[model samples]
Target: MDIDRYLGPGHRTAALVTSHGLAVADAAVRLAEAERIHEEKEELAGTLTRRWGTPCHLGLQTVRLRTGTEEIPEPWAGLSLRVGDVYLWQVAEQGRWVALGVADLDPDDEIQLLLVVTDTDPP
Candidate 1:
């Protein structure tokens, strides 16, 4: 899906879940129906782990917790983080932090998206 185009500068987190066994259409249907929430999220992270090697940091927490750091960061600070919505991780390489998670493209889309972030923070 030319996912790379969605990344880089000004990009927030992104989730890219590939159905290793299912066809593209089937995967689309599953995501659209929210059929396997946990599995899809896991696969999204697993795929990234495989592609980028193990992340220097990996965690799971609520959006509130994630945004509650001493100094809230951008995209995040501007986002309307839901109270109970879960945010999966702050995966990073070196000092660059990448917020990765699965979420709906929009409130009405009912489609799960893998959030991808690649922010370079000074060491």
Candidate 2:
């Protein structure tokens, strides 16, 4: 998904779509002013959010998507993909938005496994 051109520039300039779909879906509870409904929504959102995925799974590809840096794996050798802090973004396609969860290098400095979430935006 991070490599999907459908997200950046030609599309909506939003490459990494963060998965806040669950919370977004439960937003109604916030407006409804129902404590029970709100709690349920929160629980549901948390579960779905974790189940979806994280943006960090993109790894080096994320660097390219975020900073236009492709992974080369060359330490101090010209560059090898601009390395930096990880980031998350909300992506949209056909009015459907997704959330790219947090990212970080695993203990091995590799792409950390994560869950990404998706949700439809209200018109």
Instruction: State which candidate has the highest lDDT.
Output: 1
* Poorest 10 consecutive residues by lDDT, candidate 1: 78-87
What lDDT, from 0 to 1, does candidate 2 have? Answer: 0.31
Q: Write the per-residue lDDT of candidate 2 for residues 1-123, one digit (tens) a residue.
A: 344322322222222322323343445532343334334434544664575433221234443453444432212111113222322334434333333322222222322112222242211
Task: Please provide, for model 1 over 1-123, each residue's C-alpha lDDT reduced to its tens digit, 9 standing for 90 to 100.
Answer: 326534446555443543232333464665645557556656766877786666543333343364666455454442324112333334444444554544433443334445555464411
Query: How does candidate 2 fare on TM-score?
Result: 0.21
The RMSD of every model to the true structure, in order and in angstroms, is 7.3, 15.1
Clash total of candidate 1: 7
TM-score of each: 0.44, 0.21
Best by TM-score: 1
